[model samples]
Target: MNPNVTVINPTITEDKESKIRVAAYCRVSTNSEDQQNSLITQMRYYENFLSDSETERLVSVYADEGITGTQMDKREEFQRMLKDCRRGKIDRIIVKSISRFARNTKDCLSVLRELKELGISVMFEKENIDTANITDEIMVTVMGGLAQEESASISNNVRWGIRSKMKNGTVKFHSAPLGYDLYEGNLIINKREAEIVKSIYKMFLSGMGYDSICRELNESKVIKNDKGTKWLSASVRYILTNEKYIGDSLWQKNYNTSMPYRKVRNKGELEKYYINNTHEAIITREEFEKVQELIEQRKHPNMNLINNYPLSKKIYCGKCGSLFKRRFKNEKSYWICREHYYNAENCRTKPILEQVFYTAFMTMYNKLKANYSVIFTPMLTQLQELKNKKYGSNKQYIEINKEIAQLKEQTHVLARLKTKGFLDVSKYIEQVTEINAKIEKLNRELRKIVRCDDEDEMIEQIKEIASIIENGTDLMTEFDDVMFESLIEKIIVKNQTEFEFNLIGGLKFTENSIDNCT
Candidate 1:
């Protein structure tokens, strides 16, 4: 029986041989014909390579076209591949090189470490480095650094070339602005869009703000850019400020940075080229200069507040909480809610006449003067009584202050305990958080008491307002800008026929505009 015994070699079963799930990632920075062909070739190569291997199963070939490799976030296909790997869809990743994976060294190692932790591996074909086989990432780090350096070098060269072209006035306009077309390396006026541009400038110069201009353009169904997008304030502002409309070109207004690649405004970080007569003029330079001056004037608070547009920042819409902008129609100034002016559907508040505001102020001031004692004296008494009630006994205030002091002492004790290792960090944090929350609630009660103490300030402001109203002319027959600016804080438009005058000390008085003012 011993002589007849035979050893049977174990046969490998099909179910025991598990194939590695593989995914390929490829990226081309540009969509040039050559790059497109390279991407297609890479896809075919990955397909054939995986198909020929019995131990590998092809999962997907992720390709990102016309995307920069320096920033991993910008590569959609690369991120998608990582997401799939995280979901355990693939066991192995294949990339052409470290540069294709990431030009950022940190991003490369971070992703590699994550994959290694998942028991997954990455093979860089050109570098002949497999993450699974390598004991450490020193070589990968060095290669990634070199790749980053190469990217920075290429970026510098490209930037230099662009600046050189800009200096020589040989740079081509790849895409023309809203008013022009790029033709033969020059900006040629596109008549249709140019008209829109002209209208925008005209409206802006004619006292229409950006929102109003955008609204008018959108209402007219005017196409903005080639995308036919709806007009926005930002787009209108760009059209207004762009020097291209004045037959000039300003190059390198924005430039790119290398390490963490991003485009930033030049802002004197680099030289900018300003060439004249680069295109036909959409608006005269004088008009453009005037528009610039107006923009500056409107932007300056002193100019808008004290010099021009007295009511610019003083009017509000009670219905929609929007500022009321001044618009002149038929030689009469009207104040309409900015939201209502832009889109009537958003806000239905009707425009109020500027004269109505003036008359409303006069009437409110007169009424205040007539019944100053009846109106403000009781208010002052009420405010004083309320203040006294809050701090009269001083018991609640004292208790809150005492508790806050005790909490502060407790915090100091906790800090000392933490410093001496008498209390663990987690317990200390919990105790300190509870103490601070109690201290915060007590502080809030203290703040309420302090606010009540502001009664004297309010009483003084009301007295000053009364004195200003009474010491002046007996009858306010004419609208006085000086008095209105001095006394009125804000005029809230309640509706088409009513206005609420919020006086300097927060006294609100409503006036009927339909009967007299309007």
Candidate 2:
């Protein structure tokens, strides 16, 4: 018989105890009792389901209770599961539905792709689709899009209800504002807080600045915010500027905008409603308007009534590092160190003519423009390298995790040995302490590596700087204060004739003034 042809069936061996580890993910968007019960039910159902399957073992049940599906960062258990998945501790993930996994289409797809790369399978029960099943990918995408649209529809409906209430002046206030108490859908004056509000307005009109008013409130120790914190200048300012004190309701002064909703100051984004005499007045309308005028006057002190100049608060005295304040001398704008102008002992930096300063700034800015590519090229190249470079392999991550696990197991063994009188107590303590320290060091290194590996933020920063440069071709020809502000962080005046220009991208250049002091 030919030796190659004589074949017997080879006995294949496999780890019989090894089972596919399955983790169930559940989420509820609210802390309501009903939602909590539903969450508990999900946990129990998943536990029983996993327990009944002989081929599968329950590794973990990750549940994000009272967390919105829109925000993944807020889901602690969900993040932990992903971290575990990355560590190869999980083989499969099961979720109640795709909407429960993520409502955002992009978030859902991105997470699925990441999981796919890790060779992990996700089963969405409602969709009855397994991500490991390649044919269901299209269905998953379509369902994800539908879920996102559903989420957007819900958001829009909620917004419509809020806007309707706002337009009718029937909007609900979650918490009573300072000086007002919410009773039966109406704002009634809180006697104690109203007195404080009135005092804040009176003090402002009486020539006491916000700082002084805040100081007075603190010293009296009678006025405290809703949080029981001492009065701040900003808090005093809020009371001074609030039109609600004058019995007018300015609804929609701020509104939440965009997905992942951030509250933004309503600057003509939506229609604002101003309902007069909507509540009890803490201050008279005339007084409120007069205070507003006073505030405006303080804000815009120039003869032309400009609120702020290009370098209003950007100039810093090189010697004293104090902000240079704008002043007028013989109808000519000049900038002097505020500390030096107020108290000569604090700062003695001489004043510089605004015209002279601008000329010097332009000259330095022109020089920076001339060498823009040369100056930023090396820096940008390094950033590009960093952005393009592949981060450390997952092998290292796996190895580190394995080492951590081994260290943890050794610690447990040390405890057992000490308890059983098999090892010296001193040796156990010493070994455990040493292992813990080593583990901590490894953890720190791991965190550092992870932080460095994430180049998204760095890439964004680079893109932002690149865009500024790309759009700033005409930067040297004209004096655009906004552009100047965006690029230049601060202008340091070394002297009346010498200056340093500090750009936001960390490039600093010096220029000598050609104009002489008159």
Candidate 3:
């Protein structure tokens, strides 16, 4: 038997002689020329490496450019390669390194386990490790951890550099805002966009809410962000609150957290820099501050009310002092007291036709236009005199400003204490809340004083109202929604037929509704 021990080779069948379908994945975290070149070289190397092997067939060379490896979901090509592997179109994957494949340890191990389960293998050329030949994942795990740490280090360095630039007031504006263009790291106001920005601020100041402004823009087909995107209330609010329009730059209003990163509002979590006169002004500081105040005042817990119809939250039942809610009957809109709408027995107020309010507004506004010289002109002069009288050396104003500054400084101190673990979370929150309350109170007082200082704004508003009326069509044949929002503050149902219109500047008028207008 030992003499007859001749080796017999096993028959290799044609069905088992299929070539291994190999795929390569390459990625560059940035779009720089050097990284692009590296990516191309990696793709070429994989293609040549597989082409030289008779048993391996090149399936694809997947490449992701200008994307982060920390998040696997963001890498399109990497995901595609995995999909191909699951589809049995790939038997092996070749990557330059673990970091190139994924800088996240968990994502790396998860994908590796999935590939191994599918009878597929992954080769890390730089690490000289193959998922199929590995007895355990300890080496891969350690390598993945190193890659993750490296990514974290790189992120920290980039953040530090950006923060350094922010501190030195030398940070480049990456993209120009709606009204400006970035040229040589400077923001230059685009003339046409600047006009739109100004109009937004003006509209807000004129009592046109965010929804109204958005509607006006969209209905007029105003282009935004150089795209024909539809206007949104958020877009209007951003323009209203952004300091960039006021010739100032505020950096670090938002910041990104460490690995497993998230973008969050700064909210005292980090230091912010404010540099004034960074560019040409599209809106004055005073106008911006006033808009901020209006925004705060208009904030309602019920967001639906913020963008409701023109009469929403503006009509009230004079008898029960309940808010009027919009209702529909027979395909017509009516404003009924909330109490009456829910339980008719609770309130006796009748539902008023929505058109009545519109007609009332037109009538009231026309009257104001006719009596502009008699009513608004004298009132404007008085406001101007009062404004001039309080123009210099306001001790109360100075004291309030000082108090606000001190309170703000205290907040910074509290933030630092919390960061240093000197204050417990609950206690820190309590103290900050108290400090904010005090600051808000002082700010309210300051705003009152500021309002007095803003008689010029009121005078300008009065002039605008007069101009709209003066330029309006004779007798106002149609109900102007814009005029209604601009002039009237609220409407009160005095009775079934009588409605009282409260104007913005504390003026009131009564009008009788036309019978069966609805």
Candidate 4:
């Protein structure tokens, strides 16, 4: 909740005179602390926006932080003003824009209806939208829908663009694992770190299981990935299986077309693109081929190695017991028996949708929720640790270290070039952008450090979600698609009676006997 600002009720000395007791309201949806400037700018602009209001005015500023425009009920400031309006305290609300007011049609109408009943007016500056005029509601309803669609389109385009880049091998994982460093601006081949990669590869090749390799890496006192911690088998397998090392990019492995929150994986249904040969290779083609062969065999070259895709390895046709490779057709995703697609009589069942299986599995979502509630806690703890330690690291300290290193290296190169007379002062100044980039990164990282409270804000989101769910029954009679999607992933229709559903996070699933279990 933002600070509750009170507007000093203006002097009504003259019976016929109208007075303006005005205040401003501003909002920015991003959780970024950098948006502080933007919010301030908007508030100040609104203060000026109502400067010449000649009517009876009682304006006060109400703000919501990192809040969505899709809904109005979650906004504490907006709701507070509504309460004030109900008590006949406020006369007008000054918003910066319609999008600031709402992106959802239903929310825009509901709030405007509330204010209309209270005879309170809302003025939006961007589209010159005013709630007082009854016609403005119609315009807002149409425009807000367009705005929401535009936002969704941009999100889809961005996801596609990212997948394309990944396919082209231009976009690699942001963090190179501990064993290798990204070199040549585009290639990852850290000599010191590469040794660890080689060690891991060797262990996998020699048949040492991933868990054993993790233990070995820890026991060897080797530095873990950028995240300072012990290695785990899952992480090891992820690295081992990543095709990035061999220079082939599998693009479009995931996509985020779903809305409200556009994360590719959390959504039960996401599309992925697979592109090949994106960058300089770290492992030889022969080595990559060998690894793939070993992967197919489900054998680790070392005694300590193990394969995680054991089931995938033995995915044979139910009828012929031949390999039933996964395949897709048209725009629909499915897994048909290869023999059937090739020779219809050779297969048992027809080509079935992978998503159908997923949906069937998800029919058990309600039963799974209880189990998820338990697993969510520990999973959240471990995930946060990994995100902070690996992705974030001692982010500030590491950023400074990088800047100092860049400055020293670039400056030394400039000195050498000067001594050899191969580069002039002008050339040195013009070509020092890498060093400048480092400085800029340093500044960004420094500014970010001041807003460590971001974590707290994220944690508090649980309460906000709970509040929404509590009010959901009253808000709408029907089920909310977004909330259900946010909680559940795909349900696997493993068989007619044995479908399995998965949750968004590492939530554990507890299966109960379904009414129509196969």
Candidate 5:
């Protein structure tokens, strides 16, 4: 034996072999039948070709149809293919070309990098390029860059065509909001829907109330946003509030979130475009202005009316994740946080009146409803904690730890009463009912501090129900709490002073519910 070479015992170890699985991704963006046929042919060809090849094995074939390759998301087959690659089931991925893989440069490079890290290869048949090949990386980068440029070109071309149409007054938008429809590629009046729209406008201007309008719509079986569905006060108000029903169309209100498949709300970072006379007019400018006037009136402190618009439902208490209820004092309106309403532990937040803390809201509602312009501050305090007067400020968040002793005492009393078992079923029920009624009454009293208008119609409806059962009824009279529930959508009880609420959109006038206080 040579001095440098030494003999050693040979040892054999089992290799943990993974399955040589393969999956192919096929995509066709266009909805044309011919393109669809081409996709089917590609899928079948890959399936048969891989299965027939001696060195290759067919594991699965995922096909995404009628989805743009330029977009990374909204592609089921592509996602599945990537999933298999990550799960080690797919050792190789075969696609038609670089464009089929991804037209966006960053997306293609990121996906390629991931697969490369897993020792996987993507084969592009048209370019005759494989990730396993030495030259594939450089070629793919160039090809992917070209594909991305092409996608941008196509997008610009489409945008240009649409803009041209808009300039020529030929482009049309069919989202009628609620009161209008497309008539011969232009917006036109639908008589019945128009009447309802007009009614909402009148009610808003007169400050009748969103809850009343919602009840009226539901009673009249007004169609929902679409054909058949229940009406929501928010939806009803959205129709009344949307400006596109007039002649002006606001485009570019939002921007593309990502290169492929996501959209985010416009954060005012991008510029927006507005096109007038883009389509036929549904309502005249005078009518539109009149409707706006009504909206402004409802928001006015003097009107003291509730708005039934969809986006009006959100009133959050930054202190606790509770809703605030709307309140009215005299002719002025304010939103009261709900934590204070129920006397819950987290109720130390400050209160804001209509004339206080005006620098907060920047939404469309604030712009439309400019009722209180005084901008004074409030001095509401609970348990000796100060809170900001801003609508959604989270500055004074605190952990509440009060009322533990009271809760413990109540629990002990309940336990002792239950153990006694001396009372009959009806007597027990009566006792429990009395306690519950007391608690409910107390809670309502506390909630009254955070005023939420349930509209005159819903409030009266509940009163009518209570009136019909005036024969000195038992606890059954209080069993139906639907009136309270029907009137309030969500009461965000934020701290002790702030709260918010929304009224019900669909209401049946014949609906029966009981509340002791009308």
Candidate 6:
């Protein structure tokens, strides 16, 4: 070895001979038998290949069926795989094609860039592209662009085919709404289901609410939906409002708009076709119109009763963690747990009479007002120190350190240039002095950039809280909405007898029943 060169042991930088963790992702755009078979085949091939490989360790195989690749949110398996990759549970991912991974070019490129930063790679078998190779990125981008365009084209073509049939009055949507059955592309009323539909409409017109109708149907054990679940208020309203029961068909009431398509209700976004007498009537048109009018009337029954209560959503149940809704009983206003009011079994806590809760709250507020400084002074000091430490360890300090390293490297380069006769000695000295002066200035700025006092922020928060509440030590005789809103965050009811009041600034104090309060 040359005397000028320093020698070190080779073990420190040697690559470890660990097996690579590999996973495969597969997806099919349709749920057709043929496409499903193809997806299963692809999954089996990957499983066998990874299992048989000597260098690769099989991690997982994530598959999504009948989900379009354009939208990542809809694909559960794809999202789970990405999450696993983020958590370092996956080292490499293999997909059959770029389209299988993601058809949206922006999403595909963004995911690849993030994976690159994580030292993870994705292998697209059909394109023979590896994301780890820097040179392959441009090619991958081009391929991803084509795949996105292809998906859009396929979506447009499918829409076009449907629109053509719709224009000819032969379009068929495979939905099978409540009282209708598809027979040779025409909706025919199923008498069994139609009777149930008729009964729902009659019940609605006879002054029964949606909830009451739901309870009646559930009590009778009428299997409502295709899933055989008990009727819900929304489903009851759906059956009541359906135009199909009135012997008409409305087509294209909803449509998917643009690439990475989202299905949205068509409120004149697109043309809708209405066909008259498309099916046998379950209910008369007059009855349907009457129900619609009744629905409109019920929507704003208490429009004049405006809520001015500031603590309407602020107060919460201590037992079930539900909000306390204002209720009026026998000319008295009280706050009760909404869950308990709806179902007592869910929240067994007794209602905290509004006057009783108000007194306890005021007593606690008076105590906080008297001891504010004793509680807040030490807290402010601790927070100030933490803020200073955070500023010191911030991003600016890291960037400044990197810049200083680069400046030092440039000075060394200047020295080499002077020795090689490429730079004049005087010129080299001048450049070195200027660079050192810049470095010194940067170092001074870096030091001051850290250690900043957040006293202004701390003081502003305290001032806001102080401004919202009265500054005196006198106990509040009645409920002060301003004081409650400013100081109280939430009240957790432990039971009927006790509850904990959590304050805005992470302070908590417990209070007992009305009998225990002074």
Q: How high is each candidate's TM-score?
A: 0.52, 0.53, 0.53, 0.43, 0.46, 0.45
**Order of the predicted models by lDDT, top scorer first:** 1, 3, 2, 6, 4, 5
Question: Could you give candidate 4's per-residue lDDT for residues 1-518 as a string of tens digits?
Answer: 89999999866666434464444566676546587557656655555556666664435556666665445677766776677778877777777666677665666778788878877777777778777775555687886786677656655676667667755557645445444565543556667877777788888787665556766997998876432344554456656777877766654444433446532332224444555565666677787677667655553212212333222222335455554445536755455556777888866545555444434434434333334345445545655675466435675667676676667557545634543457886887666766677667765565456335444334333332332233223222233333343333333334333433344322334343333411
What C-alpha lDDT does candidate 5 achieve relative to the native structure?
0.55
lDDT by residue for model 5 (1-518), tens = 66797788647533323335567778776656688667657766776676656556867667777666676777856876787788878788888888878887788889988999998988888878888774456677888888777777766666677667656656666456566777755677777777777777666556545556776877887765432444544455555656676667765554444455344444476555567766545556776787667656544344433444222344567676666676666665565567766785666655555333222212212321232222111111221122122212422221111233343334334423443344454765566676666655554443343223333233334332222222112222221212232234544433333333333432221111121110
lDDT of each: 0.77, 0.73, 0.77, 0.56, 0.55, 0.73
What is the C-alpha lDDT profile of model 2 across 1-518, one tens digit per residue? 66666668747645434789899998887666698768767877887787778789888777777656678888877887999999999999999888889887778989999999999999999878888886456777899988777777776876788789888888756546799999866889999889888888888788765556766987987646422344544456667888889888888877776675655567686999887778889899899998888776654335223424657667898898889888878877788898899998887787788778667766766665667677667777787676445543466766787798788767756644553458886888799999999998878665555544435344444444445554454346544443454556678988778888876435577889868463
Off by more than 4 A, model 5: 1-23, 30-61, 68-71, 82-91, 103-120, 126-128, 134-150, 170-206, 209-234, 243-289, 296-353, 360-518
Ordered list by TM-score, greatest first: 3, 2, 1, 5, 6, 4
After TM-score superposition, the amount by which residue 291's alpha carbon in candidate 2 deviates from its true location, in angstroms, is: 2.9
Candidate 3 — which residues are off by over 4 angstroms?
1-19, 44-51, 54-57, 181-192, 218-230, 276-281, 293-518
lDDT of 6 by residue, 1-518 (tens): 65787788666542333678898898888776698767767767787787767778878777788767778988877887888889998889999888888887889899999898888999998888888775566787899998888788878887888888877778765667888888766778788888899999999788776656767998998966433344555567668878888888788877887875755567676788887777688899999999888776554423213343544556777666798887766655677888988999888866666666767788777776677667666666777677667666778877887898789768756744554458897898799999999999887776455424344344445444543332433566665643564566577777665768876445588987654321
- For model 5 the local lDDT of residue 469 reads 25
**What's the lDDT for candidate 2?**
0.73
lDDT of 6: 0.73
Comparing 1 and 6 on TM-score, the stronger one = 1
10: Cα error in model 3, Å:
20
Candidate 1 TM-score, true structure as reference = 0.52
Residue pairs whose backbone atoms clash in candidate 6:
318-492, 318-493
